[model samples]
Target chain A: MQLAVLILEDERPVREALARDLGHFGGHVRIEVAEDVPDAWAVIDELDRDGDRLALVLADHRLPGTSGVDFLVLLLDDPRTVHTRKVLVTGQADQQDTIRAVNDAGLDRYIPKPWNPDELRSVVRDQLTDHVIEHRLDPLPHLQALDAARVMPLLRTRGDR
Target chain B: MPTDVHHPRSTLPRPTHLQLAGLVVGLIAFLVPLLVDIPGLEPAGQRMLAIFLLAIVLWVTEAVPLVATAMLVILLEVLMISDQALVALPEDVLAASDYFAALADPVIVLFLGGFLIADGAAKFDLDRNLAAVMLRPFAGNARRSVLGLMLITAMLSMFVSNTATTATMFAVVIPILAVLPAGPARTGLALAIPVAANVGGIGTPVGSPPNAIALGALEARGEGVSFLGWMLLAVPLMVVVLLFAWWLLTRRYIAPDTPMALDLSSSFDRSPAAIVFYVVAGATVLLWLTEPLHGISSSTVGFVPVVALLATQVMGGDDIKALQWPVLWLVAGGIALGAGIGATGLDTWLLGLVAWEALPLTLLVLLLVAVGLGLSTVISNSATANLLVPLSLSLATGLPIDATAIGVIVALACALAMALPISTPPNAVAYATGEVDTRAMATNGLLVGGFGAVLLATVLPRVWDRLGLL
Candidate 1:
């Protein structure tokens, strides 16, 4: 099954930049962009219908009506996306909101604005590696997008079996 | 796997408290008319009252998307007032299609035109250039610098959303603020932009949503204020309030007398498309102002910029798509509510319950203005105006005062409410900068807002008579 990475950012420029920065993984992973929470859910619905696993979500904290933290909390309740890795990419999340994201949403990482592209890609790679290992998915098929060293032991074990 | 992925119930997010509140309010509103009996109230009026109540609650709580709430208002009105329903009064009372007609209201179109103009200006950097040019004169002096920034912000807000105006002007003032020492002076500079944007939004019909709502309410009553007439009253009032706000800010955050030079040169585009936009914008404003001479309503004039901008390619499909359609929907909903109020005889019935005729005109105006100011300080200015303007109009009917005057005063009062971040978008934008704290904002906002209320109550009555409106 294909793995999906969702980018939820309201600003068009930021959303496009994030999508472009992660374009190298587009061949193996579904890279999608949503401008708000509702659009993000629509993306999830489409990916689910296509039998794709939603592995990661990079969401902005501020949105039109519902906030990104609020969306992340909702994801925890959905059985299908309970294990999805959640990251908040925001410039303006307040202390209270960031704390809520960390405590309630199990946010895996926080990437502040003006982020280095290399660091962003590395975070995405690391998060995907964790998802692959934790879910016990076949690492060989998505090895290029995952950290090779971390998943090599799993690949070897599967090979021996 | 398909069943797991397609669990419709789990796929949808759970209802929020806001949503639950909206549902409860809607249920209560719908059931009230059926259960409660009021003397001299017709069944249709009762139903309209229910719809109005539901719309107001949804708007205030923001339980649903504002546009969806607007659509609900139309839907409920149509369904509840159906000819086959028990409360049906007459076939001509409200045609099913008239609800849709509210979407095409001239005032809505007027705001559409205003949005297009703002979009076109931003597309070509026209607003920035104009701001720079306007700020050139007061660049060197510290106190005048505050005035200049406030003046420019307020002027821009008259044509665009106050939030957009504040955001844009905030960028311009950031460098200036950074150069200053970290103190009240910097804080004052930050606060002035939003304060000006809030106050300046009262200057024109297109200045703010409340003004547009006021105009829509007036137009519904067959009494309208021309674009120039609004400017004639509101511009002067804004200037007075702006001066008061500037004084309050400067006194608290007293800046040094150092003359700071600023580069006012603009990189404004001189392309053919931009030139076309300028010409179209000028002509549109002219037509709006000289509407009496041209015999074309401002709403009709609104079509010019919309067509010209599209034809000139000044604003593209993406920009059009990004326009604040929700605000338009909100305005339309308010207008629809007003129409519903008028049709159901709710306006007349509610007015009858109040002995407005017995009260002195001045006392009545002050009471209305005071109520508007109080509510707006707590709720959104647009929602406040939406609730108050129509009621003010209905109350003023058959009184010695002109409904337009009261409507205009209420609109201004709504604009004047800036004591809290929740009161207006501009104030919220200023508060977000991390430079101005809530206490500072509330203290200064209350001072300015209180002074403004008194000034408006005193000034509007005298001026309305001189302007032949009263």
Candidate 2:
């Protein structure tokens, strides 16, 4: 099954830059971009129709109408995307919003604006690795996108099985 | 690798303190009219008052989506103001559908035309070309660049959405700001666009929603201001305020010795679509200005650009689809509320409560202008105009002062209330750039707003007298 990494940012420049920065994993994963919550749901529906998994979601908290936290809270209810790794990649979300995101959405990470590219890549890699391992999916095919050191044991153990 | 992050489903939507407070206020507003008898108010007027109070509170608190509140206003009008209740409207006064007909008011059509023109301009890069041409004279000077940016932004906002004008100018000025040293000049450059945009929108009826609301209110009262008449009064005020804003922004933030090299010529788009837009937009403006000769109302004239742009294929279906519907709904809601107030005779009752004869006309004008400016700084300017224009007109009926003049002054003052980021979309857009914060915006806005109010009070009366409106 194809793995999807969704970038939900309303701003086109920020969305394009985020997608471009994660281009290395595009070969093995579906790198989808959505401008808002409704667009994100359409992408999720398309992935579900194709029997693909939404492995991660990097969202901005301040969107046009429905906020990123509200969308994250929504994902918890969907059976298809309940396990998706959620990250808040914005500088605008206040403490209350961040707390709600963590408490309600099971947020995996918080990356403030003007982020380090290395840190962003590492976060994506680690999240993907965790998703693969938790679901007991074979990590060998998507090794390029994962933390190899952490997934190596899983691959080795599954190889013997 | 397997970080066990437990994802729990919370189906219950959490209501914040503000939302809960809004609900409480909304409930009280809805129930009060039914429970208690307001003095000098008919049953229908009392019911209309309840809906008005509820809508105002809900709009201010943002209890729900703004469009939702607008829809609710229409729904409540149908339910409570029906022929049976006769709470706001007399029996057989209006058909059920007539209550919602405010959505299709001619003034709303004017705004739709404005949006289409703006969208077509943006789609064809016509705005950039126009800005570049306009700024050419002011190039090479640091202070003039600030003035030029403000001038271009303000002028564009006079015919387009203030937010769109600010966004377009923000993109154009960013590169210029980047080249400047990281200091007050950069902040000044960032802050000037929004300030000018806010001031500039006072130039015409279609410049902002508040202007349209004022125009719509005036038209409903059978005392409409002509397109040329409005421009004659407002454009000069806009120019004066814009110049003051430019001075205030530059003197406070920009250094005199700051070097500048603005190259806007390269940003111009000389495409066929742009050419078509220019011809159509120019013709529409000319027609609007010479309305007395043509005998066509300005709102009727607005349809020309809408048809011309579509016929020329300058604006596509997607552009039409992307029109700011919520803003239109918001304006429609204001119009509907104004109609409801008029029908219910709530305007008369409210006027009776205010002692217009007790205060001098000049003091009353200043007080009304101050109230409009103050309320707008805290809420949406459109909302401020919606709340104030109708009341000011009603209040004018009791006094010797002219209602049309009061409407004009109140509308202009609404546009001038830029004391905070939440005051207007343009201010919020500038604040989002991070180059200028709320503190910087408020400081500059207070000074500009103060100057604008004084200028209006001193100059508007003379202009009104000249136009034979006083």
lDDT of 2: 0.81
DockQ of 2: 0.03
Q: Which one is best on TM-score? A: 2
lDDT (C-alpha) at residue B270 in model 2: 68
The CAPRI classification for model 1 reads as: incorrect
User: Each model's fnat?
Assistant: 0.00, 0.00
lDDT of 2 by residue, A1-161 (tens): 77889999999999999998888888878899999999999999999777678999999999999999999998877778888999999999999999999998899999999888888988998899899988877664575576544543342121000
Task: Tell me the tens digit of each residue's lDDT in model 2 across B50-132.
Answer: 89899888877778867687778877877887554445455444455766788998898888887777777777777777898
**Alpha carbon lDDT of each predicted model:** 0.81, 0.81
Clash count list over all predictions? 0, 2
Off by over 4 Å in 2: A1-161, B1-15, B84-92, B267-271, B467-470
Chain A fold similarity by TM-score, each prediction: 0.97, 0.96
